[model samples]
Target: MKVDYIIVGLGLAGLAFSRELEKENKSFIVFENKSQHSSKVAGGMYNPIILKRFTPVWDAENQLKIAIPFYKNMELLLGNKYDYKVDVYRLFTSIEEQNNWFAACDNPTLSSYMVPKVITDKFNGIDALFGYGKVTHTGRIDTNKLIEDYHFYLEKSNKILYQDFEYNRIDFNENKIQYKNIETSKIVFCEGFGIKKNPFFKELPMQEAKGELITIHAPELDIDFVLKSSVFIMPLGNQLFKVGATFNWKDKTSIPSKEGKEELLTKLKSILNVPFEVVEHVAGIRPTVKDRRPLVGLHKEYKNIALLNGLGTRGVMIAPTVAKELYNHIENDMLLRNEISIKRFENN
Candidate 1:
């Protein structure tokens, strides 16, 4: 069979790219192994603030404007509710942090997202002595729901192959690619950390990190907004909260380690002054980069092979715009920005 593109992996990256192809009425097929947990088990929150330093994330406004409507349109396509507009309450660890919030609020770049007034009373069973900063225009996409429903949509259209893609099987020609019985004009890899196994693109630097999250039944800590401190306690409704996540750079395996769970509990307990029972624990490798920018663009030698990855911890905010960028680069011969283009690492 012949198609315009063959996408590997159906995580946020692949889904976002597929949407672009759908918009352009391009013929494509996607291969997903369902092995990566980063998207399905993600906290799925998209906030403009770094929270660690009370500064806006890079290109926050542009990404938000593109991602919000992109996912909302998906809601219309799938007839499932996954997009949510919720406020994020960032707890102040010290009085100095409170002052920093005010300083950030005064900055022109952050004024639009930073709530001027500090919220001292948003939820009970939480320790917020210095008060909290309310982040506006922030929310989450039920990533699990989005993945499952989007995959179903693709399957309904006969556009998905539910299997692990073997890189060795692909035969690259001058202007096309072939895999098994399939032929395509181009192939895009959105494999997340799994890209490490792809011989063609493994040379790119991928500073991956393992992250773990825990789900707990904390009836006493019922809240509407996401609570942020050392760890994020996001309400998943039904008296359940998804508190996570512990970042470990050493371990790259997907297995949920005991050390990770204990670390998360320690951090969660630091801010949440409520008792909770652990219900589940999940882990995945974030396909992060050294520069903390996304990895996008075509391979230097193989023009038909491309990549859309390195979304790191902010995949929900970064994927849509980056996907659009990749699509334009391929279909319109548009040059990718230096920071995000894979060519940045060509010498290394």
Candidate 2:
């Protein structure tokens, strides 16, 4: 009943951390209740640009270097092909927007990912008015399948426990933690928005956002690239495209709202003239923080307790490196950057 680590939650964050532990040959046990769906039902797009403003995402180059290979390794380890390399076609709304894209391409940091050439609208249904700017080194991950496959792998290795983690069951010590009969050198919390219920780390501010997505059968819209406008229309093949998502800060419920579906359809119609059928609608809560950075580091009060949450809309690109940073910080006393480290929230 003893191990090197007891990890709670098995979302992208937990999975990435577990991979690191396994690579190091560290013994650990994971508790997952399958309560969250943000990572599970995510759009899984890994773009380095802020498409809304035509600017580079924070640390895009470095994050891409680490994230791409990390997921590739996961594909090899799990013996599944979930990582996809596809271009993101950013539809321009106006001449001004196209000019701004030109400006972004001039940036040395964005030059690699942003293509200066304007692509003609290949599909008649898409409203590519001023043409589109294709973003390179961008792709999508089949996160649902990745999570499912990784879970099965963990179960096969007897490293995972399928249950909810009760906060009260844990006993904290100077150098170890005990939960029931299980004792571990440390415990890490990767509980997504579920961290709100964790008493030990609830003090940290987690501004959770609710997102809704829909799958549509757009037979005529045969496109290979990810389409971005007010919302993203991603090609999932088999004449099915994943269209989503609507972000609502006030309503954090997991239920798929009628209004959410209507909003998505409204946006989809604005860009796509083709008729489509809604195949499915799903909803999930994203663990977002006010500053829009990940939360990683040891707990302020308990040294052995750590947290890895708040990945927000870009979990696919951020989780791998953040998890590795958290692991190194714990195992080697490495310093985590102030922007991402939980230490920035001193009051917590």
Per-prediction TM-score to the true structure, in the order listed: 0.98, 0.98
What's model 1's overall lDDT? 0.91
lDDT of 1 by residue, 81-132 (tens): 9888888988887888888989999999899989987788856678678888
Predicted candidate 2 versus true structure: per-residue lDDT over 1-348, tens digit per residue: 999999999988999899999999999999999888899989999999999998778877788899999999989998999898999999988889888999999999899888888887577578676899999999999999999999999989899999999999989777778899899998999999999889977888888899999999988987898999999999998999999998999996888999999999999988888889999999999999989999999988788899999898889989988999999999999999999999999854
**Could you tell me the C-alpha RMSD of candidate 1 in Å?**
1.1
Runs in model 2 with CA error above 4 Å?
Answer: none
Clashes of 1: 0
Each model's lDDT: 0.91, 0.91
| Clash totals, every prediction | 0, 0
lDDT for residue 93 in candidate 1, whole number 0-100: 75
Reference-based lDDT, residue 254, model 2: 87
Cα lDDT over the full model 2: 0.91
